[model samples]
Target: MGETIDAGGVDLWVERRGTGPDVLLVAGLGDTAEAWQAQLDGLADRYRLTAFDNRGAGRTPLSEEPLSVPRMAEDAAALLDALGIPAAHVAGFSGGSFIAQELALGRPELVSSLVLVSTCARPDAYFRSMTGFWHWMAERAPSERAMLEAFFLWVYTPRAHADGTVARIVEETLAFPHPQSVDAFQRQLASFVRHDTLDRLAQITAPTLVLAGELDLATPPRLGRVVAEGIPDAEFEVLPGEAHQPFQEVPDLFNARADAFWREVGARG
Candidate 1:
Protein backbone atom coordinates (compact mmCIF):
# COMPACT_ATOMS: atom_id res chain seq x y z
CA MET A 1 0.00 0.00 0.00
CA GLY A 2 1.04 3.60 -0.60
CA GLU A 3 1.02 6.28 2.05
CA THR A 4 1.26 10.07 1.87
CA ILE A 5 4.39 11.12 3.68
CA ASP A 6 5.31 14.72 4.45
CA ALA A 7 8.68 14.65 2.81
CA GLY A 8 9.80 18.17 3.62
CA GLY A 9 7.07 20.54 2.40
CA VAL A 10 5.74 18.11 -0.17
CA ASP A 11 3.36 15.30 0.66
CA LEU A 12 5.00 12.59 -1.37
CA TRP A 13 3.03 9.44 -2.12
CA VAL A 14 5.34 6.65 -1.00
CA GLU A 15 5.31 2.87 -1.43
CA ARG A 16 7.45 0.25 0.30
CA ARG A 17 7.86 -3.47 -0.39
CA GLY A 18 9.93 -6.53 0.58
CA THR A 19 12.61 -6.56 3.29
CA GLY A 20 16.38 -6.32 3.95
CA PRO A 21 18.71 -3.51 2.86
CA ASP A 22 16.92 -0.31 1.83
CA VAL A 23 16.65 0.47 -1.86
CA LEU A 24 15.23 3.78 -3.06
CA LEU A 25 13.98 4.04 -6.63
CA VAL A 26 13.48 7.41 -8.27
CA ALA A 27 11.24 7.63 -11.30
CA GLY A 28 11.78 9.69 -14.47
CA LEU A 29 9.85 12.58 -15.96
CA GLY A 30 6.06 12.13 -16.10
CA ASP A 31 6.40 9.02 -13.90
CA THR A 32 5.15 8.04 -10.49
CA ALA A 33 6.01 5.46 -7.87
CA GLU A 34 3.97 2.97 -9.87
CA ALA A 35 6.42 3.30 -12.78
CA TRP A 36 8.81 1.03 -10.88
CA GLN A 37 6.28 -1.81 -10.79
CA ALA A 38 8.63 -4.21 -12.53
CA GLN A 39 11.45 -3.56 -10.07
CA LEU A 40 9.13 -3.82 -7.06
CA ASP A 41 7.81 -7.13 -8.34
CA GLY A 42 11.21 -8.51 -9.37
CA LEU A 43 13.45 -7.37 -6.54
CA ALA A 44 11.12 -6.98 -3.55
CA ASP A 45 11.81 -10.51 -2.29
CA ARG A 46 15.44 -9.67 -1.62
CA TYR A 47 15.43 -6.02 -0.63
CA ARG A 48 13.23 -3.45 1.05
CA LEU A 49 12.33 -1.18 -1.86
CA THR A 50 10.79 2.27 -1.67
CA ALA A 51 9.32 4.40 -4.45
CA PHE A 52 7.66 7.79 -4.27
CA ASP A 53 5.95 10.32 -6.53
CA ASN A 54 7.72 13.58 -7.25
CA ARG A 55 5.99 16.84 -6.33
CA GLY A 56 4.77 17.48 -9.87
CA ALA A 57 3.70 13.91 -10.57
CA GLY A 58 1.16 11.31 -9.43
CA ARG A 59 -0.56 11.83 -6.08
CA THR A 60 2.03 14.35 -4.98
CA PRO A 61 0.83 17.96 -4.95
CA LEU A 62 2.67 20.61 -6.93
CA SER A 63 3.60 23.40 -4.58
CA GLU A 64 4.49 26.99 -5.35
CA GLU A 65 8.12 26.27 -4.55
CA PRO A 66 10.13 26.30 -7.79
CA LEU A 67 10.99 22.82 -8.92
CA SER A 68 14.72 22.12 -9.33
CA VAL A 69 16.95 19.09 -9.19
CA PRO A 70 18.29 20.03 -5.79
CA ARG A 71 14.81 20.54 -4.33
CA MET A 72 13.79 17.08 -5.45
CA ALA A 73 16.94 15.66 -3.90
CA GLU A 74 16.06 17.36 -0.61
CA ASP A 75 12.66 15.73 -0.77
CA ALA A 76 14.31 12.33 -1.18
CA ALA A 77 16.47 13.00 1.85
CA ALA A 78 13.45 14.10 3.84
CA LEU A 79 11.55 10.98 2.78
CA LEU A 80 14.44 8.86 4.09
CA ASP A 81 14.26 10.80 7.37
CA ALA A 82 10.48 10.33 7.58
CA LEU A 83 10.91 6.60 7.06
CA GLY A 84 13.74 6.45 9.66
CA ILE A 85 16.20 5.18 7.07
CA PRO A 86 19.60 6.71 7.54
CA ALA A 87 20.71 5.72 4.05
CA ALA A 88 19.79 3.60 1.06
CA HIS A 89 21.03 2.22 -2.24
CA VAL A 90 19.78 4.97 -4.53
CA ALA A 91 18.83 4.30 -8.14
CA GLY A 92 17.35 6.75 -10.63
CA PHE A 93 16.25 6.80 -14.26
CA SER A 94 16.29 9.75 -16.70
CA GLY A 95 15.30 12.92 -14.88
CA GLY A 96 15.33 11.05 -11.59
CA SER A 97 19.00 10.34 -12.21
CA PHE A 98 19.55 14.10 -12.41
CA ILE A 99 18.00 14.44 -8.98
CA ALA A 100 20.02 11.49 -7.69
CA GLN A 101 23.24 13.11 -8.92
CA GLU A 102 22.50 16.25 -6.92
CA LEU A 103 21.53 14.18 -3.88
CA ALA A 104 24.79 12.25 -3.88
CA LEU A 105 26.82 15.42 -4.32
CA GLY A 106 24.97 17.30 -1.58
CA ARG A 107 24.34 14.53 0.93
CA PRO A 108 26.74 11.69 0.23
CA GLU A 109 26.07 10.20 3.67
CA LEU A 110 22.51 9.33 2.70
CA VAL A 111 23.51 7.37 -0.40
CA SER A 112 24.98 3.91 0.25
CA SER A 113 25.53 3.26 -3.46
CA LEU A 114 24.37 4.94 -6.64
CA VAL A 115 22.76 3.50 -9.77
CA LEU A 116 22.03 5.87 -12.64
CA VAL A 117 19.98 4.32 -15.44
CA SER A 118 19.60 6.27 -18.71
CA THR A 119 21.18 9.47 -17.44
CA CYS A 120 23.76 12.07 -18.37
CA ALA A 121 26.07 14.25 -16.31
CA ARG A 122 25.51 17.22 -18.58
CA PRO A 123 23.51 17.99 -21.70
CA ASP A 124 25.49 18.30 -24.90
CA ALA A 125 24.06 20.24 -27.86
CA TYR A 126 22.11 17.23 -29.05
CA PHE A 127 20.71 16.53 -25.58
CA ARG A 128 19.76 20.16 -25.05
CA SER A 129 18.00 20.35 -28.43
CA MET A 130 16.30 16.99 -27.85
CA THR A 131 14.99 17.94 -24.42
CA GLY A 132 13.89 21.29 -25.81
CA PHE A 133 12.00 19.47 -28.52
CA TRP A 134 10.37 17.28 -25.91
CA HIS A 135 9.28 20.35 -23.98
CA TRP A 136 7.90 21.89 -27.14
CA MET A 137 6.09 18.69 -28.02
CA ALA A 138 4.63 18.39 -24.55
CA GLU A 139 3.30 21.90 -24.87
CA ARG A 140 1.90 21.62 -28.40
CA ALA A 141 0.62 18.04 -28.66
CA PRO A 142 -3.11 18.04 -29.36
CA SER A 143 -4.14 15.41 -26.80
CA GLU A 144 -2.67 13.53 -23.87
CA ARG A 145 -2.52 10.30 -25.86
CA ALA A 146 -0.89 12.10 -28.76
CA MET A 147 1.71 13.58 -26.43
CA LEU A 148 2.43 10.16 -24.98
CA GLU A 149 2.76 8.64 -28.44
CA ALA A 150 5.21 11.30 -29.55
CA PHE A 151 7.28 10.80 -26.41
CA PHE A 152 7.18 7.02 -26.74
CA LEU A 153 8.76 7.18 -30.20
CA TRP A 154 12.13 7.52 -28.50
CA VAL A 155 11.37 5.83 -25.17
CA TYR A 156 11.06 2.30 -26.53
CA THR A 157 12.97 0.38 -29.16
CA PRO A 158 11.42 -0.41 -32.58
CA ARG A 159 10.83 -3.99 -31.37
CA ALA A 160 8.51 -2.73 -28.64
CA HIS A 161 6.42 -0.92 -31.22
CA ALA A 162 5.95 -4.17 -33.20
CA ASP A 163 5.38 -6.24 -30.02
CA GLY A 164 2.23 -4.39 -28.79
CA THR A 165 4.13 -3.11 -25.72
CA VAL A 166 3.61 0.54 -26.57
CA ALA A 167 -0.08 0.02 -27.12
CA ARG A 168 -0.51 -1.70 -23.77
CA ILE A 169 1.42 1.03 -21.94
CA VAL A 170 -0.62 3.77 -23.61
CA GLU A 171 -3.89 2.12 -22.60
CA GLU A 172 -2.70 1.82 -19.01
CA THR A 173 -1.35 5.37 -18.82
CA LEU A 174 -4.62 6.74 -20.18
CA ALA A 175 -6.46 4.83 -17.45
CA PHE A 176 -4.15 5.99 -14.66
CA PRO A 177 -5.93 8.23 -12.14
CA HIS A 178 -3.19 10.71 -11.33
CA PRO A 179 -2.17 11.75 -14.81
CA GLN A 180 0.22 14.68 -15.06
CA SER A 181 -0.99 18.01 -16.42
CA VAL A 182 0.75 19.65 -19.36
CA ASP A 183 1.72 22.62 -17.22
CA ALA A 184 3.32 20.38 -14.63
CA PHE A 185 5.08 18.40 -17.32
CA GLN A 186 6.53 21.50 -18.89
CA ARG A 187 7.62 22.85 -15.51
CA GLN A 188 9.40 19.61 -14.68
CA LEU A 189 11.00 19.54 -18.09
CA ALA A 190 12.35 23.03 -17.53
CA SER A 191 13.93 21.92 -14.28
CA PHE A 192 15.47 18.90 -16.00
CA VAL A 193 17.11 21.01 -18.71
CA ARG A 194 18.75 23.14 -16.04
CA HIS A 195 20.57 20.19 -14.45
CA ASP A 196 24.35 19.92 -14.98
CA THR A 197 26.64 17.91 -12.69
CA LEU A 198 29.61 16.85 -14.84
CA ASP A 199 32.15 18.74 -12.78
CA ARG A 200 30.69 17.85 -9.36
CA LEU A 201 30.43 14.09 -9.93
CA ALA A 202 33.94 13.51 -8.63
CA GLN A 203 32.76 14.61 -5.18
CA ILE A 204 30.33 11.69 -4.82
CA THR A 205 32.05 9.14 -2.60
CA ALA A 206 29.48 6.34 -3.08
CA PRO A 207 30.16 3.38 -5.34
CA THR A 208 28.34 4.11 -8.62
CA LEU A 209 27.00 2.14 -11.56
CA VAL A 210 25.70 3.88 -14.67
CA LEU A 211 23.53 1.92 -17.09
CA ALA A 212 22.44 3.12 -20.50
CA GLY A 213 20.44 1.53 -23.27
CA GLU A 214 22.26 1.05 -26.56
CA LEU A 215 19.13 2.12 -28.42
CA ASP A 216 18.15 4.99 -26.15
CA LEU A 217 18.03 8.21 -28.16
CA ALA A 218 16.89 10.11 -25.08
CA THR A 219 20.10 9.36 -23.18
CA PRO A 220 22.55 7.41 -25.27
CA PRO A 221 25.56 5.46 -23.97
CA ARG A 222 27.97 8.31 -24.76
CA LEU A 223 26.27 10.57 -22.22
CA GLY A 224 26.20 7.77 -19.67
CA ARG A 225 29.95 7.32 -20.27
CA VAL A 226 30.62 10.96 -19.41
CA VAL A 227 28.82 10.43 -16.08
CA ALA A 228 30.84 7.29 -15.32
CA GLU A 229 34.10 8.90 -16.40
CA GLY A 230 33.53 11.95 -14.23
CA ILE A 231 32.78 9.91 -11.13
CA PRO A 232 36.12 8.56 -9.89
CA ASP A 233 35.60 4.81 -10.41
CA ALA A 234 31.98 4.49 -11.50
CA GLU A 235 31.21 1.59 -13.82
CA PHE A 236 29.28 2.11 -17.04
CA GLU A 237 27.41 -0.48 -19.11
CA VAL A 238 25.10 -0.39 -22.10
CA LEU A 239 22.23 -2.86 -22.33
CA PRO A 240 22.13 -4.17 -25.86
CA GLY A 241 18.85 -4.09 -27.79
CA GLU A 242 17.20 -2.06 -25.03
CA ALA A 243 15.88 1.49 -25.06
CA HIS A 244 15.16 4.06 -22.35
CA GLN A 245 12.97 1.90 -20.15
CA PRO A 246 14.95 -1.32 -19.97
CA PHE A 247 13.91 -2.06 -16.40
CA GLN A 248 10.36 -2.46 -17.64
CA GLU A 249 11.20 -4.02 -21.02
CA VAL A 250 13.62 -6.57 -19.51
CA PRO A 251 13.02 -6.80 -15.76
CA ASP A 252 14.97 -9.97 -15.03
CA LEU A 253 18.21 -8.68 -16.50
CA PHE A 254 17.77 -5.30 -14.87
CA ASN A 255 17.03 -6.80 -11.46
CA ALA A 256 19.93 -9.26 -11.57
CA ARG A 257 22.43 -6.56 -12.56
CA ALA A 258 21.23 -4.12 -9.91
CA ASP A 259 21.08 -6.81 -7.23
CA ALA A 260 24.58 -8.03 -8.00
CA PHE A 261 25.99 -4.52 -7.80
CA TRP A 262 24.27 -3.86 -4.48
CA ARG A 263 25.52 -7.16 -3.12
CA GLU A 264 29.06 -6.36 -4.21
CA VAL A 265 28.89 -2.95 -2.54
CA GLY A 266 27.58 -4.52 0.63
CA ALA A 267 30.29 -7.19 0.64
CA ARG A 268 33.11 -4.68 0.25
CA GLY A 269 31.80 -2.71 3.22
Candidate 2:
Protein backbone atom coordinates (compact mmCIF):
# COMPACT_ATOMS: atom_id res chain seq x y z
CA MET A 1 0.00 0.00 0.00
CA GLY A 2 2.97 2.30 -0.41
CA GLU A 3 4.13 4.10 -3.54
CA THR A 4 6.12 7.22 -4.23
CA ILE A 5 6.04 9.66 -7.09
CA ASP A 6 8.06 12.81 -7.66
CA ALA A 7 5.69 15.69 -8.29
CA GLY A 8 6.38 19.40 -8.38
CA GLY A 9 9.92 18.66 -7.25
CA VAL A 10 8.77 16.77 -4.15
CA ASP A 11 8.31 13.11 -3.38
CA LEU A 12 4.65 12.30 -2.76
CA TRP A 13 3.36 9.25 -0.86
CA VAL A 14 0.61 7.17 -2.38
CA GLU A 15 -1.30 4.14 -1.01
CA ARG A 16 -3.58 1.61 -2.59
CA ARG A 17 -5.68 -1.43 -1.71
CA GLY A 18 -8.00 -4.03 -3.33
CA THR A 19 -8.04 -4.88 -7.01
CA GLY A 20 -10.33 -4.11 -9.93
CA PRO A 21 -11.08 -0.97 -11.91
CA ASP A 22 -9.02 1.93 -10.62
CA VAL A 23 -10.81 4.21 -8.12
CA LEU A 24 -8.74 7.08 -6.80
CA LEU A 25 -9.85 8.79 -3.57
CA VAL A 26 -8.74 12.37 -2.90
CA ALA A 27 -9.11 14.09 0.47
CA GLY A 28 -9.66 17.69 1.61
CA LEU A 29 -7.46 20.32 3.23
CA GLY A 30 -5.26 19.10 6.11
CA ASP A 31 -6.42 15.63 5.15
CA THR A 32 -4.23 12.66 4.28
CA ALA A 33 -4.77 9.48 2.33
CA GLU A 34 -5.88 7.81 5.56
CA ALA A 35 -8.97 10.01 5.48
CA TRP A 36 -10.34 7.44 3.07
CA GLN A 37 -9.92 4.53 5.48
CA ALA A 38 -13.66 3.99 5.43
CA GLN A 39 -13.98 4.03 1.66
CA LEU A 40 -10.82 1.98 1.19
CA ASP A 41 -12.24 -0.79 3.33
CA GLY A 42 -15.77 -0.38 2.01
CA LEU A 43 -14.99 -0.26 -1.70
CA ALA A 44 -11.72 -2.12 -1.91
CA ASP A 45 -13.36 -5.47 -2.49
CA ARG A 46 -15.02 -4.05 -5.58
CA TYR A 47 -12.39 -1.79 -7.05
CA ARG A 48 -8.71 -0.96 -7.15
CA LEU A 49 -8.58 1.73 -4.47
CA THR A 50 -5.82 4.33 -4.43
CA ALA A 51 -5.33 7.35 -2.18
CA PHE A 52 -2.44 9.77 -1.77
CA ASP A 53 -1.21 12.50 0.50
CA ASN A 54 -1.51 15.93 -1.09
CA ARG A 55 1.57 18.12 -1.30
CA GLY A 56 2.92 19.23 2.11
CA ALA A 57 0.72 16.88 4.16
CA GLY A 58 0.88 13.40 5.69
CA ARG A 59 3.83 11.28 4.68
CA THR A 60 4.38 13.47 1.67
CA PRO A 61 7.15 15.96 2.35
CA LEU A 62 6.21 19.61 2.39
CA SER A 63 6.68 21.37 -0.91
CA GLU A 64 9.47 23.92 -1.40
CA GLU A 65 6.80 26.61 -1.72
CA PRO A 66 3.03 26.90 -1.52
CA LEU A 67 1.04 24.84 -4.03
CA SER A 68 -1.89 25.81 -6.22
CA VAL A 69 -5.06 23.71 -6.60
CA PRO A 70 -4.27 23.02 -10.23
CA ARG A 71 -0.78 21.93 -9.27
CA MET A 72 -2.26 19.48 -6.84
CA ALA A 73 -4.44 18.17 -9.64
CA GLU A 74 -1.37 17.61 -11.77
CA ASP A 75 0.22 15.86 -8.84
CA ALA A 76 -2.65 13.39 -8.82
CA ALA A 77 -2.13 12.69 -12.50
CA ALA A 78 1.55 12.25 -11.84
CA LEU A 79 0.86 9.75 -9.08
CA LEU A 80 -1.38 7.79 -11.43
CA ASP A 81 1.30 7.86 -14.09
CA ALA A 82 3.88 6.63 -11.61
CA LEU A 83 1.59 3.73 -10.84
CA GLY A 84 1.18 3.09 -14.60
CA ILE A 85 -2.53 3.81 -14.42
CA PRO A 86 -3.68 5.68 -17.47
CA ALA A 87 -7.14 6.47 -16.22
CA ALA A 88 -9.21 6.02 -13.07
CA HIS A 89 -12.67 6.58 -11.71
CA VAL A 90 -11.85 9.54 -9.49
CA ALA A 91 -13.82 10.52 -6.37
CA GLY A 92 -13.04 13.50 -4.19
CA PHE A 93 -14.56 15.29 -1.19
CA SER A 94 -14.31 18.95 -0.19
CA GLY A 95 -11.07 20.47 -1.50
CA GLY A 96 -10.34 17.16 -3.10
CA SER A 97 -13.49 17.66 -5.18
CA PHE A 98 -12.12 20.92 -6.51
CA ILE A 99 -8.95 19.13 -7.57
CA ALA A 100 -11.04 16.40 -9.15
CA GLN A 101 -12.80 18.96 -11.31
CA GLU A 102 -9.47 20.40 -12.28
CA LEU A 103 -8.25 16.92 -13.17
CA ALA A 104 -11.27 16.31 -15.36
CA LEU A 105 -10.91 19.64 -17.06
CA GLY A 106 -7.15 19.79 -17.37
CA ARG A 107 -6.34 16.11 -17.89
CA PRO A 108 -9.52 14.81 -19.37
CA GLU A 109 -7.82 11.66 -20.64
CA LEU A 110 -6.93 10.55 -17.12
CA VAL A 111 -10.42 10.71 -15.61
CA SER A 112 -12.69 7.82 -16.60
CA SER A 113 -15.52 9.05 -14.35
CA LEU A 114 -15.97 11.30 -11.34
CA VAL A 115 -17.77 11.55 -8.02
CA LEU A 116 -17.99 15.04 -6.55
CA VAL A 117 -19.01 14.89 -2.89
CA SER A 118 -19.54 17.69 -0.40
CA THR A 119 -17.88 20.05 -2.86
CA CYS A 120 -18.28 23.36 -4.65
CA ALA A 121 -16.98 25.00 -7.81
CA ARG A 122 -16.31 28.35 -6.12
CA PRO A 123 -15.89 29.67 -2.60
CA ASP A 124 -18.42 32.27 -1.51
CA ALA A 125 -17.74 34.75 1.29
CA TYR A 126 -19.22 32.42 3.88
CA PHE A 127 -16.97 29.59 2.74
CA ARG A 128 -14.03 31.94 3.01
CA SER A 129 -14.94 32.83 6.57
CA MET A 130 -15.26 29.20 7.60
CA THR A 131 -11.91 28.26 6.08
CA GLY A 132 -10.42 31.39 7.63
CA PHE A 133 -11.46 30.07 11.01
CA TRP A 134 -9.55 26.85 10.37
CA HIS A 135 -6.49 28.86 9.36
CA TRP A 136 -6.74 30.87 12.55
CA MET A 137 -7.02 27.78 14.73
CA ALA A 138 -4.16 26.01 13.01
CA GLU A 139 -1.90 29.01 13.66
CA ARG A 140 -3.07 30.67 16.85
CA ALA A 141 -4.86 28.01 18.87
CA PRO A 142 -3.41 27.25 22.31
CA SER A 143 -2.98 23.59 21.39
CA GLU A 144 -3.35 21.24 18.41
CA ARG A 145 -6.13 19.51 20.33
CA ALA A 146 -8.11 22.72 20.52
CA MET A 147 -7.51 23.43 16.87
CA LEU A 148 -8.82 19.97 15.93
CA GLU A 149 -11.86 20.32 18.19
CA ALA A 150 -12.81 23.51 16.41
CA PHE A 151 -12.18 21.86 13.05
CA PHE A 152 -14.44 18.90 13.86
CA LEU A 153 -17.15 21.32 14.89
CA TRP A 154 -16.92 23.07 11.55
CA VAL A 155 -16.74 19.86 9.49
CA TYR A 156 -19.51 17.83 11.06
CA THR A 157 -23.24 18.32 11.69
CA PRO A 158 -24.89 18.95 15.07
CA ARG A 159 -25.83 15.29 15.42
CA ALA A 160 -22.31 14.09 14.72
CA HIS A 161 -20.83 16.82 16.86
CA ALA A 162 -22.94 15.60 19.75
CA ASP A 163 -22.58 11.90 19.06
CA GLY A 164 -18.83 11.69 19.82
CA THR A 165 -17.90 11.92 16.17
CA VAL A 166 -16.00 15.08 16.92
CA ALA A 167 -14.08 13.23 19.63
CA ARG A 168 -13.27 10.46 17.17
CA ILE A 169 -12.00 12.95 14.60
CA VAL A 170 -9.92 14.65 17.27
CA GLU A 171 -8.45 11.31 18.27
CA GLU A 172 -7.55 10.53 14.66
CA THR A 173 -6.05 13.98 14.25
CA LEU A 174 -3.79 13.37 17.22
CA ALA A 175 -2.73 9.93 16.04
CA PHE A 176 -1.05 11.33 12.95
CA PRO A 177 2.65 10.73 13.52
CA HIS A 178 3.76 13.55 11.23
CA PRO A 179 3.29 17.11 12.36
CA GLN A 180 1.52 19.65 10.11
CA SER A 181 2.67 23.23 9.73
CA VAL A 182 0.47 26.31 9.62
CA ASP A 183 2.40 27.57 6.60
CA ALA A 184 1.53 24.44 4.62
CA PHE A 185 -2.08 24.72 5.69
CA GLN A 186 -2.25 28.39 4.67
CA ARG A 187 -0.93 27.51 1.24
CA GLN A 188 -3.60 24.83 0.83
CA LEU A 189 -6.35 27.17 2.07
CA ALA A 190 -5.32 29.91 -0.34
CA SER A 191 -5.31 27.39 -3.16
CA PHE A 192 -8.79 26.24 -2.18
CA VAL A 193 -10.24 29.77 -2.36
CA ARG A 194 -8.62 30.24 -5.73
CA HIS A 195 -10.57 27.28 -7.06
CA ASP A 196 -13.17 28.40 -9.58
CA THR A 197 -14.10 25.74 -12.11
CA LEU A 198 -17.48 27.18 -13.08
CA ASP A 199 -16.23 28.44 -16.39
CA ARG A 200 -14.39 25.23 -17.29
CA LEU A 201 -16.78 22.61 -15.93
CA ALA A 202 -18.62 22.43 -19.23
CA GLN A 203 -15.48 21.03 -20.80
CA ILE A 204 -15.45 17.97 -18.57
CA THR A 205 -16.40 14.99 -20.69
CA ALA A 206 -16.45 12.30 -18.04
CA PRO A 207 -19.78 11.17 -16.59
CA THR A 208 -20.01 12.88 -13.21
CA LEU A 209 -22.03 12.33 -10.06
CA VAL A 210 -22.62 15.13 -7.57
CA LEU A 211 -23.60 13.92 -4.10
CA ALA A 212 -24.39 16.03 -1.07
CA GLY A 213 -25.49 15.57 2.51
CA GLU A 214 -28.67 17.25 3.70
CA LEU A 215 -27.01 18.97 6.63
CA ASP A 216 -23.66 19.80 5.03
CA LEU A 217 -23.29 23.45 5.93
CA ALA A 218 -19.64 23.26 4.87
CA THR A 219 -20.46 22.91 1.17
CA PRO A 220 -24.29 22.74 1.24
CA PRO A 221 -26.66 21.01 -1.18
CA ARG A 222 -26.73 23.91 -3.62
CA LEU A 223 -23.06 23.38 -4.32
CA GLY A 224 -23.84 19.94 -5.57
CA ARG A 225 -26.61 21.32 -7.77
CA VAL A 226 -24.27 23.85 -9.27
CA VAL A 227 -21.85 21.09 -10.25
CA ALA A 228 -24.62 18.90 -11.64
CA GLU A 229 -26.03 21.74 -13.63
CA GLY A 230 -22.69 22.71 -15.10
CA ILE A 231 -21.81 19.31 -16.53
CA PRO A 232 -23.91 18.21 -19.46
CA ASP A 233 -24.36 14.67 -18.11
CA ALA A 234 -24.17 14.76 -14.34
CA GLU A 235 -26.46 13.32 -11.67
CA PHE A 236 -27.09 14.64 -8.17
CA GLU A 237 -27.96 12.60 -5.10
CA VAL A 238 -28.96 14.16 -1.80
CA LEU A 239 -28.71 11.85 1.18
CA PRO A 240 -31.10 12.73 3.97
CA GLY A 241 -29.88 13.14 7.58
CA GLU A 242 -26.26 13.18 6.52
CA ALA A 243 -23.60 15.86 6.89
CA HIS A 244 -20.26 16.73 5.33
CA GLN A 245 -18.63 13.28 5.15
CA PRO A 246 -21.47 11.10 4.03
CA PHE A 247 -19.18 8.31 2.85
CA GLN A 248 -18.00 7.91 6.41
CA GLU A 249 -21.30 8.74 8.14
CA VAL A 250 -23.35 6.42 5.93
CA PRO A 251 -21.12 4.17 3.86
CA ASP A 252 -23.84 1.90 2.51
CA LEU A 253 -25.90 4.71 1.08
CA PHE A 254 -22.86 6.45 -0.33
CA ASN A 255 -21.47 3.30 -1.96
CA ALA A 256 -24.84 2.29 -3.39
CA ARG A 257 -25.33 5.61 -5.11
CA ALA A 258 -21.75 5.67 -6.34
CA ASP A 259 -21.76 2.06 -7.46
CA ALA A 260 -24.98 2.57 -9.36
CA PHE A 261 -23.66 5.64 -11.09
CA TRP A 262 -20.40 3.94 -12.03
CA ARG A 263 -22.36 1.05 -13.47
CA GLU A 264 -24.67 3.29 -15.44
CA VAL A 265 -21.78 5.28 -16.85
CA GLY A 266 -19.58 2.28 -17.51
CA ALA A 267 -22.43 0.86 -19.58
CA ARG A 268 -22.74 4.05 -21.56
CA GLY A 269 -19.02 4.27 -22.06
lDDT of 1 by residue, 1-269 (tens): 99999887679999999998999999989899998999998898999999999988999988887999899999999999989999999999999999999999988899999999999988889978988898889879899899888899989999988999999999999999999988889888888888999888889899999999999999999999999999989999999999999998998999999999999999999
lDDT score at residue 67, model 2, on the 0-100 scale: 78
Candidate 2, position 71, lDDT: 90
Worst 10 residues of 2 by lDDT: 1-10
lDDT of 2: 0.86
- Candidate 2 lDDT, 1-269, residue by residue in tens: 67777754568888889988899999988888888888888888888999989987888876576578889998888888877889999999999999999999988999999999998988889898988877777889898898878777657878877888778878878887976788888888889988999887899999999989888988999988998999987988888888889888778788888878877878887
Cα deviation at 154, candidate 1, in Å, is 1.2
Q: Lowest-scoring 10 consecutive residues by lDDT in candidate 1?
A: 130-139
Q: Runs in model 2 with CA error above 4 Å?
A: 7-9
Every candidate's lDDT: 0.93, 0.86
